[model samples]
Target: MNYISAEQLTKSYGVKFLFKDISFNINEGDKIALVAKNGSGKSTLLKIILGREIADGGEVIVNKDIQVVLFDQEISFDGEDSIEEFMMKLDSAPINALRNYHQSLYSTDTKFIEEALAEMEIYKAWDLENEMKQILSQLKINDLSVKMGMLSGGQIKRVALAKLLTETRAEHRHTLLIMDEPTNHLDVEMVEWLENYLSKEKITLLLVTHDRYFLDSVCDIIWELEDQKLYVHNGSYATYLENKMIREENLSATIDKANNLYRKELEWMRRQPKARTTKSKSRIEAFYETEKVAKTNTSKESLELNFEMKRLGKKILELRDISKKYGNTIILDDFSYQFQRGEKVGIIGKNGVGKSTLLNIIQGLENYDKGEIETGETIRFGYFSQKGLQYKEDERVIDFIREISDNFPLANGKTISASQFLRLFLFDDQTQYSLISKLSGGEKRRLHLMYVLYQNPNFLIFDEPTNDLDLPTLTILENFLAQFQGTVAIVSHDRYFMDRIVSHVLAFEGNGKVKDFTGNFSEYRQYKSQQEKAGISETEKIAEEKPQTQKSKKRLSYKEQRELEQIDKRLPEKEAQRQIVMEQLNNETDYEKITLLSEKLEALTSEIEMMEIRWLELQAVLED
Candidate 1:
């Protein structure tokens, strides 16, 4: 049975066309992933289907007597309220009854949590509130006593999602789940868990997510929204890729024929007078339609990476006797390693197990409680972080990019203007001057990434860089990083990306247990599964076991420790110099001199982190 069907859907914003006569239907057991680039009307179409927004033409017919649960992209709470209190407010029950229902869930006061599930066997009202807690816990939001307002962006998104899943899973009636970017704020572990849950559940789901792994694992069907049209692929993600490749081959031939017809029509139009007759007018409209199809750039062009960088020296980075603590919680302890050249390391861990903290410590953005770090003299770094590049709302794309370097040097030794460089990253001529705040989330991420490359750092550190970015951009970035010459470190939850880009893994187990693995995430999972099935703890084999040293080994000399302390002072100085050079590049007209100085300044900025680390690997080896 069909749950919903949208027929001849047409919508537009003034002169901008969003969709034209697009149609699709949802079946009773379909798990669909809606894929599209940023600002391509994915969210708009979802709103139209939910009846929150009206399409200019056509109608959506949802099956009668079916419950619809939605998890919107943007959801907010009005005022301060505890999580428990918030739940009670959402329900239309009496205070005492709602209180009992809330308390029975995951509370020691009663075994009523299970009893509520038994009560829900008859589909009672109270079970909705209590039964949903199972989902909330699985989503990793367990603290009910916490205030809703205190939740982080990711936490709030999880709360909204938990509510939606619980609502849909509560009753046995037909239901539809419409989710927008459902995996946007999820970690890898949580994303995997949700994927498993959705794959087994009977509810019909339509969700928009950029995580390719989630799409592949959970969805049985894929709906690609492109060029104001919908293309349905009735299989898995791999099948969708295979089918789309065939469709594109056919489309290219059609486009070539249309282009030829459009050119002939254009030449004929220049010779003929303005057509007033109905037949001639209809013919002119046909020419215009063909021209539009030929000129569409959507999904036709992919972004390119043009990286021209300085040579990497023998020295890279070293971490020795490094330890970090937040109050009483230990993060990293006496970690020691020497980063070699051309190594791609992917860091994996739970939400707060200090993967990002380790990156920050290496980048000299954060301080450690103990230990020293080392760096090479010629090292330059490009850090692409989720908290990257804070741009003012009024800032233009070109203007922001000019701050890093007014010119980008190509491998052929030719230089491109800042605006031209931005275009290569998919920013168009008109969009170069558009306000930063007006861009989509993925666009903003792309813009930030452009600035990261603008510095021309030889080394790169990315901390959760794929969070809000679309899949195409991620694909291009993966290709770029795979070919990059310098050492790289990634802190990402996108497991597919990790497998593709990195050769090694740094798996961070909780409680300051860090281990090095030899292969990609998939291999690590296989090894972990084998260990689990054999009744062996993963720690016994994989923990970062300190090498046994002789008792005669000497500790760090007083001079070395003092030099490590001086790194705390020198790092700030180098950072200040990089900022000054960046400002000068914005105003300077001398492109040649500016580019050289910008590279030197960036190298200096990275040296601050490297300076302190280089001390640990110096002539004195502090063996423990």
Candidate 2:
């Protein structure tokens, strides 16, 4: 059943066209990822379909039986309300008894609390509050007393997510969720949790996100917005890439034919007399139309970086015995590493494990508690932070570019005008005079990036560079970075971007522990998993090697011990099965088969974990 169907939809921003005559249907149980470049009306389409924005032509028809939840770009909270109050306000269909019960937990109002629990049991919402708390804990939101308005952007996003994913809804009908950049402020763990929830939940989702790993894992169908039209591709993100390649290939061949036809028509027109005959005039007009289309239909040009990069010396930045602490919390302890010349490093950690702090220390803006730092003779640095550029509201785009530099002096001694550089980043003649405030979030990020990279620094530092960027822009940025001659140290949670860009990683485990991983995120995750299994297996073998005590009376009988040993054997088999299922998940193209296998894998994983606990219990008993 189709949850939402958009037919012949058209939209425009004054003289700038967004998409026209676009048609698509979103079915129930469909996890569709809408991907497009910045300012390409991906969000506009969602708004129109959700009835928040009006379309220029045609309409979006949503099924009357379904409910829609939108996790919009901007999250709002009411005045002077606690976290629970704000959550309950958004969850409008709240159970009165449950609400009172939650409030009662922090108070001594015992007269009514017990009665509310009884009422909750009547509705079988006995576990509802506990479930909500568990979700909050997973999201790292522990302080319930904090006001909604006082929370940071990331925290507010998390609270909003908790409301959608964990809060109770009215019974009966299913809900269709539409989100815009839902993974914007999320760390990798949070994104993984959301991915599992969305993929396993019995809800339909339409979301726009730049996290390629999240998109590939959660979405089964991809809707690509390009050249003012929607192209729908089935299967995973990998499949989408395959389809896009095929489409571009076919389009390239068609354009070649058009170009051939265009050249022949040009010759005929040049040779023909300047006659006002209908046949001659008609052919001339047709020739112009074909030429216009052939030009418009051609693929976008790649970004070229002619960086005037500073020369790097052999002694690159190095740190020995670096330590930092904030009050009672230790962020980094006894950390030491020597950054090599032309090294591409990825910095990864949870929300507050000093990723940005480390960058600040490197730039000499923040002092470490204990550290000996050394830098090369020549290492000019440019840092692109997630704290987005602060532009004057009235400042024009070209003026801002000119502020950075009037013209770029390439490393090879070539000069390009500031306006020409703007054109390279997709700002055109008309947009040169446009106010900074007019740019989309992603466009603003791109402009900020231009400001950072055009400075000709040999060392580049990027903090959460993927935040508001669309995937296409990210691809361009990746291409630009690939050609860059500088050393880069990036702090980003984007697994795909990290894997593509970096050669090594600084993995921040919690509690002032850091692991130096010599590979990308995916490779490191796999390596860590295998190491953990091996460690556990080795520990078990050493226990078996130990001699039995002389006075030992078996606390656990021989049969129970045998059962536990058998469990160890079965655990590895189940783990192997899990790996096989995961490999199938990565390779499988059929949706139904993928769904069934995913469910089976989830169940099998849960059972294995439970059995491992049982095995531990039996081991403890025997040892005692």
Candidate 3:
């Protein structure tokens, strides 16, 4: 049953309609990901659903007993409240119990103290405290007792999440947790932990996020908000993308057929002689109607971007025995890597793992200690920082672009004007003169991107370029990056962007090591998984390898030893059965055969899960 439904939803901001006539449904246990670019009404729609904001015109129907928890990116807590205090306030029972307990401490009368104790017993306040503490401990927020006002944005976000996790109503049916960019300020480890938690939980989640890895791991359905409509696909983000492409292809084919028919009709009309007869007039009218219908079905003209670069020297940049130290912390220790021209690379790590630091060092924006940094003489670099475009508060948008374009001349041997550049970036006359301070986050980012491309550098480095971009812009950028000829190095949490653009991945592992793999994000994940299976230490991999230490021995403890033996014992049997089921599923066309194969696969999966859990237990014991 649909837990929430929006019919003919229309939202407008001033003269612009953010979205119109949009309709979709969210059911219980559904994990939906709303993906769109900035200013695409994703947040607005969420607000509408939550009744925080009213749509211009629409009927929103929410099922009875459905509780929603919305985590807005702009959420802020007031001053002087500790994390514990805030959590208690989210659920009044805990707060009331705490209040009574405090009151009892001050009370001299035994009757009042006894009553307070009875109240605490009834509310189970001790259990709530224990659960809250456990949650804090799991989130690594135990030592953080600072007031909410004192916490960093990332820390506050964590505290908010912890409160939500602890304060959930036990009796609430069909709860929907809505999160907007929840991963934005989270560290890599925190994101992974959240993904694991969400995957294990049996709750409905509707999240709008740019974090592709999080989406891929957590979301089973993708709700793409594009062209003022919501498109639902039942699968992971990657599968959704594949299916969307197929749909677009089909649309293209339909348009092509219509165009072909229209052309044939035009040819037929041209071949016939003009007559004053009634039959000829009727035929002409019918042709005009068909032509109008064909025109309506035609595809819009999309921008064609091509990034073709000249061949560069073999070594674009190289780092040898590089170690970067900030205060007493060592971020990169004796890290060595080489970037070759025409190579597309992605840099990934948990937040604060020095991904940005490495990018800055490569861009020559910062210096590193104890390392030799080398770059090809002919290398022209383009850098897009994670902070995106930084402009003075009072700076005008036109002035910003003109300043960047001052060095470059237009095609007619004239100085490139700000208006011309703005048009290229999709900002028209009205927006050109607007204050940079007033521009949306996405607009500012787009301006920076326009500047980067206008520079026409050979080597490009982007740090989370997709952070605030809307879905349409992201699609355009993806296509542009795919065809870009220069060497590109990117640091992004968007796995889809990384998979589509990068050819290799350089993952930063904290404590002075970076793992280098010669493939995209998916391939790098596979490599990491293999490394984990082989028991390769990331720290050891980062350090310079000696001839003797290169071929490291794999040491297994007693527990691991037993588990490995069991896995070996079970593999052949499972593999034989798995192969037989796969063959049957592949050959079977009937529904019943397919259903039976699916059931067999499900059973096999259950067995695999059990084995994996047992193996993990053994590994944990071995590590201990």
Candidate 4:
């Protein structure tokens, strides 16, 4: 069964032709992945199919009965409702019934509760509610009562995803799931969980993502959009790559053959006079067709990075007894490590586990509570963070880059102009002069990366650098980092990129525990799997053995004892703060102020819980 069919699709933006006369079909059970460069109209095609956008000269026919669920990169919400209220607004009967059931649990009216219960049973909303809760929990959305306005950008994306997935299941219709950059802003563990979930579910899917491991596992067909054309490969990502190479090679060879024939025809035409016979006219027409193929461009635009850094001294970065925390939440505790001159380390952990915080502390953007950090004189840090580059929206892309440096120095001492540097990063002449606000999200990320590389620093620190980047850019960046001469510390969720770039891994376990492994991410994963199979839980093992060695091998230091005392003093203050915020929320009538007070109350509650847990641990140590 065909879910959607598009014919002769032609679209353009200003003077640029995105695609011309393209045709495709999304059949039932087709798990497709659309791959393309940053600005290659992948999202636009999806919009056209979903009837959200109109094409210049084409029609998309979608089955009226099939349900389409789009997980777009930019979700639209007014940011005024709680998560439960937001979900209840969806047009799913089960969702509405479940919301009523939950509300009745808090109601004092017995008649309302009985009616709600009957509706839940009729709609089978109990199972839907359980599944929604599970989805929210796995995505790390613990506070459903919190307003949507209080969430971060990443958290908002996660919430949108959970809502979409739950809604699709509840509707009980034939689902055609379409996602754009679904893995963005997710940690590695979350990505893995999503991969597993999608692979197990029997839903038709079409998504645009740069996660190669995910594509290889979940998608069976590859849809490549390039050069105003669509090429379909009926296999996995690995097979698509191999087949694409073969196809390009064959096209080049055919073009070369056409050029030879066109040259012979040109000689014949130059020697003869104007043609009068029908046979001569046909030969002239054939000559023009041959010439067209001969002139086909086979050269592809590629991203190139070959910049050398300043010489590194013998002394590199070193941290001693580093400890950081917010109230009682420990980010780092006595974390000590000496980074070598040319080391590349990958940081891996769940979200909010202090990976980005560690990078900020190393760069001195954030302060540590207790630590001594030292760096060599030759070290110049180039930090690319998740906070992203702050740029004037109206400024031209070229002007933004030029503000950094008009010329970028290469490894061989040759310099390239700002325009040339932008071109190397796949920004064309027209795009260079365009406003930054007009660029795509991936394009902005690529531009920021170009700015970071232009500085020519000896030490590089990147936080979530692969979040919005396309696959081609990621491939070249990985190659460049593999040969980079300076030290690199990267916090990325891209497993393929991490496996290719890093030599070691730093696993940021929660509660200030950091485990350093002398191997790449793949190797570390294998080691972890082995440990799990052998029934070894690191946290459980540590808990079991800590009491025996608490007084002898490990004792609370002066700073730790002071930290315990501070937590004791702050717990009561945090509880009082929570009480005040709750009262303020009750008295507040303005929606905005209520949202703020609710956020404050949630923060205080979390802080108090952590402080109480830390206080108990400290007491246990003292008793030991």
TM-score per candidate, in order?
0.78, 0.82, 0.71, 0.83
Please, what are the lDDT tens digits per residue for candidate 4 over residues 1-624? 899999999999988998999999998888899998788888888889888999999889999889898998878876889887776777877877887888898999999999899989999998888898898898999888999999999999999999988987899778899998889888888899999988888879998999999988889999999889999999888898898899999999999999999999999889878755788888989999999999997766554556657889998898888999988999998887779977999999999889989998888889999989998889899988776668987899999988878988777878789998888777888999999989888888888888888888889999988888888778767877877889999998989888888977889988998876655787677766656776867777557544544442356776576566456434543554455567668999999999877887787687788888887888787777
Query: What root-mean-square deviation over C-alphas does model 2 reach?
Result: 11.1
lDDT of 3 by residue, 166-202 (tens): 6563323568889877776665557777889888788
Of candidates 3 and 2, the better by TM-score = 2
Q: Which candidate is the best by TM-score?
A: 4
Alpha-carbon runs more than 4 Å astray in model 3: 94-140, 169-174, 246-304, 308-315, 391-439, 522-624
Error of 4 at 498 (Å): 0.9
Model 1: per-residue Cα lDDT over 527-597, one tens digit each: 55655676767454333222212211235456555454444333433454555557667888888988887
Which lDDT values do the candidates have, in the order given? 0.76, 0.80, 0.74, 0.84
> Would you list the rank order by TM-score, best first?
4, 2, 1, 3
Error of 4 at 484 (Å): 1.2
CA lDDT for candidate 1: 0.76
- lDDT, candidate 2, equals 0.80
How many angstroms is residue 308 displaced in model 2 relative to the true structure, after the best TM-score fit?
2.9
Question: What ranking emerges by lDDT with the best candidate at the front?
Answer: 4, 2, 1, 3
Per-prediction RMSD in angstroms?
Answer: 12.1, 11.1, 10.7, 14.4
Clashes of each: 6, 0, 4, 0
